[model samples]
Target: MELRHLRHFVAVAEEGHITRAAERLGMQQPPLSQRIKAIEDELNVQLFRRKPRGVELTEAGRVFLDRARATLAHYDGAFEATRSAARGEQGRLCIGVLPTTLFHPFVPLIIRAFRTTYPQVSVTLDECMRAEAIDGLRNQQLDIAFLRSAIDEEVDLNAYPLLNEPMVAALPSDHALARSGRDAQSLSLKDLADEQFILYARKLGPSFYEATMAACIRAGFTPRLGQEAPRITSALSLVAVGLGVSLVPACMQNMTMNGVVYRRLKGAVQPKAVLMIGLRRGDTSPVVRNYVSLVRKTAKTFRPSEKEAR
Candidate 1:
């Protein structure tokens, strides 16, 4: 039988009179009675006993009524769940981000705001290098990504420019520059001509490393490349060990490493670029859209405090 048959049966059973049931269902008594009879015939069982006063349910009718009500409830719940998922109120969102972004002052704010707003949506975050994040996004393994560069290769992905962070130099505490009584206020590439430098992996993304090298070249010297680190933290840690000085995003200052000192680079344009994020184009999912909006709002209000200037 169809859902209409079950509905008619339930209405007649509840009212104990076909006339009353049809009135409640906005139908006529004869059609409602025929629908119920069709349901019983399809099941090959007598579902009711008729008397001059009214109708009474049989044992089979009682059991069928319970099953019909439960089935209808299940369908109702399924419809609601589907609608919620479509509205982005309920679903899973996997986000990929650069490991360095975890230390950025505004990243946590954006995550917390999104979580608070979409309490029903579940979010998973993965910390990866820029290249890995882009790969994950393209492969559909990640819903969105936050990184230094935009995703230009994939036409299906859209990038949102968040904020720009200037690059700074990280020097070891025992280095000669650190020994000088001069505070680590500002430095020039010329000042680092004779110093060993740590570099990020060229395969990861060349923009930051290339920018640093270009600045040094503009100063009429080639940097003495000492070592290369795959990730920003590893590079900073290498600098902490007195291996070499490295150019890093300004957000690295928030990471408290004992033996590393951060200094602003002057006289040359340091590597500076807006942090752009990629999301599936036209995603329009409430969770994704809300997250993008929160990121934009956070970027506007975020001003690093003095405590974050370390």
Candidate 2:
């Protein structure tokens, strides 16, 4: 009727003698015999053929032995699964990232490391806008989000700064500046004042839009705003086609977008882009804690000359 009874039947059936079975189970022989008798009475069938020296399974006992063993195995596995879930060793992590965030090496590198450490945890990665990523965390739809650090101002979420790199100019390969003799040297932000700027749309990232615009203003002239894209990487595509010049994160230079070139920008402080991890406030899940700890460790070793800007 219960798991203990199944285990008792299996022990007696396997040992072939009630006295020896009780010894193996750390119980007395008399109580073991009574339990066996109770099972037979409850089922209205004889489960063993008793002999002077030992006992042997009846036809029905052989079938019941197989079922009892299977039942114990299933219960043991389910019990372990519950413990694993409580320990955070098994479950799911739903992660969100902005399209441009993954371009930074740290994003994928940390994710790979986490997967290696917690192979039992399932991870789901999604690319989302800043608003969507924030909303996902608030609604319990996301466990973590990699996004621009500008969102650190958000009161409802906790954002950890990961990387900070100066902004640079993205020009069409055929543009005069991309081909000029000064290409090897950094240029003042004022140099691109006359060119139409391919801007990241303001609605998707208001802080990014405003910071870029403010940097241009400090350069002595407001940039001529042209085509707008949802993200800096998408803006690069427009720059490649001569739609307009763009100011983007220095790390973006690693993107192998054909016809696009990155040049260092001088005197543009506010245009710098910073990456951060955003999580819901008061999240105590160990899996999320483990990921944040990894992010902190990885962020510490990032050097400006390596895996980031030049």
Candidate 3:
């Protein structure tokens, strides 16, 4: 009926002697024998037969012994699992990540390090848009999210600014800037003033969309917006084919599409894309707490290496 009863039953069954079973259980012989009798009465079946020197298990006792042992084992496992969860070593962590931020070095570094540190925690990644990431955090569907900006409207949503990576220009392989030896070193935003630009819709990621437009405007020209795509990666693909050029997060340079070359921007003030982690204000789950802590530590050490993506 109870875990202690199952344990007592198993110890008695295994030892096959009342005195020995009590010694194994660190209890008295009389109390152990009475506990075994109580189990049979509670089950409404004869589980043991008295013998001259010891007790013999009846057929019913053998069956009950198996069940009792199995029950005790399961109880032990459940107890340990509960402790593990309390320790933040076991649980599910659902993360909603913006598509644009998903491939960044900061994002993956946190995920890999968290996975290594809490191997028992289940980490689920949902690659999503900025809006979806916000919604997931607000609705409690996601434990945390990685994105370009923090949604300040929701009082319950807490944002931690991770790192800022400079936006670089994605140029076509045969484009003038890519081909020019001097411009090849670094290109200014003003250099792309006359070229057509591919812009992904703001709804896909408003932070990226705004950063691109703002950089171009400050450079002294309203960029000729020629093509529009649903996503930044799609816009980059368009740029690869000479349709247009686009500004993207520096970390995105790792995509390595054919005909696409990434160049640093040169200026006193350059556009910077930010990566932020958003979470609910009062989430107290150990798994979530561990992830947030790991994220902060990782962001501190995140350095963009050419091979960090690999």
Candidate 4:
């Protein structure tokens, strides 16, 4: 029988009178009685017994009533869950983030604000390299990504540029530069020209790699590469161990490496590293849309000092 039949049966059973049940259901008494009768007929069992002033439920009726109520509750709950998800109030958001992006203030700010607004939405973070994050987004393993560059090739994706800041140098704690009596803030790229560099792989994040090389070239020397890592954080780790100095996104200075110190590059023209959010083109997920909007808004309020980005 249809759900309407169960509802009619429940109303009549609860009221103990067809007339009262019809009033509660906003239907006529005769129609209510007919619906109740149809339910019993479908089940081939007597569900109600007529009385002088009202009706009484048969043993079969009591058992069926429990089932009907539970079914209704389940349907109601399912409907609410679907609606909430569509409204972006409930769902799981898988985010693929580059390690470098995590050090940026705006990224965490956006995530925290989004969580506050959508408390019911669960967020999962996947820390990955630029190429891995992009692959995750394209493969549907991730709903959105925070990365270093936009997709230059034709793809069904959209990249929203979030932050563009100047690169900074990461030096070992005992390195000559750190021990120099000169002001660390006034350190120049040209000064590090002769030092070995710990660099990020070209394919992993080409944008930052190119920027580092460009800045070194502008300083009149190609860097001596000593080691390369797939992620910026890893490069910094190498710098901390004194393998080589590294030029990283200024925001990456947020990472606390015990043996490393961050210094601004002194130059009139410095190369910049960029952070971008990538998602599928024409994505209709409400959760993803809300996150993207929140990121844009958060970026607006983020005012990093020129010194912070040096």
Off by over 4 Å in 3: 41-56, 193-197, 213-229, 307-310
Candidate 2 residues 1-310, lDDT tens each? Answer: 8899899899999999999999989999999899999999999999999999879999999999999999999999899988887777788999999877877777878889989988999999988998899999989899999987556566878988888777778889998888868755567788887899888899887756777899988878888889789887789889988899988777787788999988887663546787889997788898888788888898999665643565
Task: List model 1 lDDT by residue over 51-99, tens digit each.
Answer: 7977999999999999999988888899998988777778878888787
TM-score for each predicted model, relative to the true structure: 0.74, 0.83, 0.83, 0.81
1 or 3: which has the higher lDDT? 3
Looking at model 2, which ten-residue stretch has the lowest summed lDDT? 301-310
Encode model 4's per-residue lDDT on 40-91: one tens digit a residue.
Answer: 8889999999999989999999999999999988988999999999998999
lDDT of 4: 0.85
Candidate 1 residue pairs that clash: none
Please give the RMSD of candidate 2 to the true structure: 3.1
User: Which of candidates 1 and 4 reaches a greater TM-score?
Assistant: 4
lDDT of model 2 at position 157? 86
In the range 28-119, model 3's lDDT, one tens digit per residue, is 99998888888889899999899998888999999988878888888889999999999899999999987678778777777888999999
The models' CA-based lDDT, in order, is 0.81, 0.85, 0.84, 0.85
Candidate 4 error regions (>4 Å): 44-46, 49-58, 88-92, 112-122, 184-194, 217-226, 265-267, 303-310
The per-residue C-alpha lDDT of model 3 at residue 218 equals: 83
Position 305, candidate 3: lDDT? 81
